[model samples]
Target: MLNREFIFSNPEVLKWIDNKFIFVAGDDWYRRRAQDDASVWFKSIARKARRGKNGSTQQGCYAVTPKGELLRFINTSDPKKFTVTMLEALKLWDGVVQDKKVTIPEMKNFDYKVNVPPIDPSKDVLIKVQSRALTEKDGKLERWNSNGKAGGKPAVGHLWIKQAEWQSIVQNFKTMEVGETTPLTKRLIHRIAKFHLIDNTRGEGPAWESKDLKHAKVTLTRVKNGFAIRGMFLLTNQKKSLSHSTELSGEITINQSTARPVSWTMIAYGKHRGEGKYTRNARPGAQPLGFTFEFLPASKIRPIDLVPPQHMRWQRGYWEAEKH
Candidate 1:
């Protein structure tokens, strides 16, 4: 059971009497309230509440069709800004819903600031992954010590990945300091990324997590084309059977123009012990991996056909048959 009447209806909601929408709790979304359906045409917005800047959460408003295609959202939920905000939503709904082109408010600079690179999808991004022992020259392998060294040019741990349309892409990968080529399970790559593509496009939306983190501090700022949101939190608990826990810090570079992540990176450090396959040769403590995501335009993505260099071998992990 949760609070259902948390959202108050005002005169602004009256005009969209025919539209259908759900009013959910800002703190907990599972609680739902009824909507007013006094009109004939069902046009509404798919609104949800998210943690806003300054360590507060607010319910965002949206204008959408019956099928739940979003037209626009009201960014601010401040009482003082209600009148002006609703006025704007009204004009957008009237114009777009009515299918008559209407002039809308031009997006301007935000109230906060952060350092973010200006992104232009017009240019193709060259996505590359640097490796330590994956490249060799004349039967000699270039290796990176525990102190940190990037191997060679050909061992450029790059992948012929597919194009995607989401912010966060998390998938399990089996990697090690194997031969000259760190081959990945191509099928798993396709399976994981493709799964998110469908889930992201649907109304499921990004994981709206609010608990399980402590001493969390976040600084959010709107950048040129989107937002640069960085946050840090402490995790002191781990599952009983698990021998590792981590203090996590992550940054999400969101393309506000599209509400998709332009780049997302997470750094974990604290205590860790390898489990499963790594148990036989797993080291304890201080294994920090710089997991980064760089999204590229779908049109620029090419087919992946990885081939090992001369005298180098490829090691395919769990995604494929245990082929050496």
Candidate 2:
């Protein structure tokens, strides 16, 4: 049985909590003396201890999950910082706030970063096999090395594809090389980019899926009118620590699918404008309201996905793929 009370209370003395490396010699004694809640905690600790080949003289313990997620364990001295770090870690693990494109300060200038959704190589192979047909000059049969080299101008239609499949399609596409035996056709590129977006949204909440569940991913931009229904993308991570940065140009579009007629608006982080109906609203959650991109005044009735380009770059420095 696990120690329910000891684990839930966040006991101060982790060692005495019965999950430390020090209890090897007297495992039974420590287990018996420990609170019932401590059992589960102990088993977790014991498992890690075994992995470390028994306890060490090191002062602090390793912060790990029941499944052995190794969070950097620091000495329990700075409770405040630890709490903050832990919350950040949890957010990262579950991809919390992954969709929100935040502005990160840089030494010289700030760069906007996006999270690249997971792609499967096998899907790439399939996309390569299923090439969209296209016409070449004079209606002759077109041949291309890759899908990216094939497609020509689109015919005013859209292809809604899953995230993994779309990535695979992109991966298989190759531009025609100069003087290559087989000249690449224009239709391939058209097929590859044919209004198809990779839907990265899968789980509950914004992080798991794209802002619009229908979209595989979205490109952020300043709103003149509203969002595009074809699709939109948001950042997401399997790990809670997946946070990316974006540059907030003069004003940007915020697509709220729930809002009927979808009231498109903007809120600046830290700016003040002369009082009027243009007053900004509070951040969707608890963030401070900055500036407002009110659509009511413009009467533009701009559709969603019709905004300034949001240069989103994924953070390559912080990628962690689970080992299969």
Candidate 3:
């Protein structure tokens, strides 16, 4: 998150990268093992990093030639350090020559399931979800600090609502009274509680199991603008070691004539405890963990926005979360 907000977001850094590199971003999970040209090329460069071929995580920046000769690799999030490494890599490239005789291999056995986006931007609703860890300091909530340093930046993920599900919601709204409230489907509620409302502020958090969602309920109250969303959820692992008890509140604006949602906003604020295997170094006890969901316009979608949800690797599990 810091890397995106600081390094990649810097105009000067972006100019250098845009002018000199064919920057490609990928998910490490599939790239490490997939049988494809892209994955093969990624492995060739990644194996030279400090993590090497055996480390559990080979996540870092790499500068390589078309022939897969690694020039430099660094894992620091510091923009200055990263920029220096980029400079050094460029200097090394100046002394090297490309091997035109080497031909790129055909991608025959690549994994297609891992490469597809979860939702169609033009047809489905995409909600941008951001989660962050917070702490109470002097009676006010602030970004959590780890060992006196700034806490990790907000984690981002997208929530997908199928067109069918969205249309069902609109139809339901049309039949409701002005102030009547209706509970959302268990499937939708569970999906949000299990996958979207996770504490991924520090790293990749695990999805909540069906049994972990002890209580989940979200209702929509018909209103003048659209509908009012209110709910609460409680999730806990079998051992009760990891938990998130949160209250949700938000509003949705709809196009009355078309019965389509024009704006959707939701916030989940609560105390979270424990951590996942990858997401460690959590506070000793419960702490504030908040997630905000906002409707993202299709026109505003960018290349980064096309990245699948963290848990979307298991497409069935993500879509039918309640059944799972």
Candidate 4:
């Protein structure tokens, strides 16, 4: 299912000089893994990215770690920021030499939504508490005095939704690419070291055995509140088993296959912000954010989405010969 030209096309990206190893992986690897994940060679690279420090470069096509490792690369949502930082880094790294390495910078925007849990309904209390402060004269709050003390002034307090309407929320995903210049954070480095990339290819001959497998690229998506994220994935084989789920603490209310009729979920993580909501709290922290949708038949989802690719391109190929 993989072609040779596709595998070794990006020579610059495929070749690297590091203190330890040299490897090349990018579009070819991503495509191959995306296509037939059972291909033996696909598994090798898959293991490499998952088991090694190698990750994608800023451009999102492909990149190598300083230690000489292959990784899936991506760019941040803000293209300008990525370009500026990369250029600056290149200038710094080049020093006297005018020639600078063209690198893609990783981009990730963190947005946080504060959630207020719903209050229980049933409660009994005496109506002894009486105050003339908040009573409206003409359906409006009464004016207050300048003394700061309440003189028929309005009583301001927390507002609660007596009844809430269920609105369809859209789950947005932000992609970030990693590169040589990309600063390695302690948490990210740790994830790369402990992460496990798996290849999910449908097996032939015996239904249970893998026929021809290829590595697959799985990324993390940060979504807060109760909004559900959806995507159109290429299911090459109709028989291929597909399942969707989160890998973190939040709950998965609805996991649907078809897009025609979307699904909905109540009681989720964070708090819901109206339409086109945006926050600055979503980030990688104590709870690794991501969702694992194992192409394999039997799999479960965690709370967060997998980290999105920093900068990557869609290609139609695989990386097999390199391993063989």
Best by lDDT: 3
Q: Please give the TM-score that candidate 1 achieves against the real structure.
A: 0.25
Residue 198 of model 1 has an lDDT of 13
Q: Between candidates 2 and 4, which one is better according to lDDT?
A: 2
Index of the highest-TM-score prediction: 3
Off by over 4 Å in 2: 1-60, 63-172, 175-206, 209-231, 234-324
- List model 3 lDDT by residue over 203-315, tens digit each: 78889999999899999999977789999999999988899999999998988886666899999999999988877777878899889999887789987887878888787
Provide the lDDT at 33 for model 1. Answer: 23
The C-alpha lDDT values of all candidates are: 0.30, 0.27, 0.82, 0.23
TM-score for every candidate vs. truth? 0.25, 0.17, 0.84, 0.16
Model 1, span 181-224: residue lDDT tens: 22123342322221111111112212111221233443333333
Query: Per-residue alpha-carbon lDDT of model 2 for 169-244, expressed as tens digits?
Result: 2222223222222211222222222111211111011122222221122222222333221221223344422222
In model 3, residue pairs whose N, Cα or C atoms come closer than 3 Å (at least 3 residues apart or on different chains), thus clashing, are: none
Give candidate 3 misplaced runs (Cα > 4 Å).
Answer: 1-18, 47-57, 65-71, 77-81, 92-110, 116-118, 147-152, 257-259
Whole-model lDDT for model 3 versus the true structure?
A: 0.82
lDDT of model number 2: 0.27
Model 1 lDDT on a 0 to 1 scale: 0.30
Weakest lDDT window of 10 consecutive positions for candidate 3? 144-153
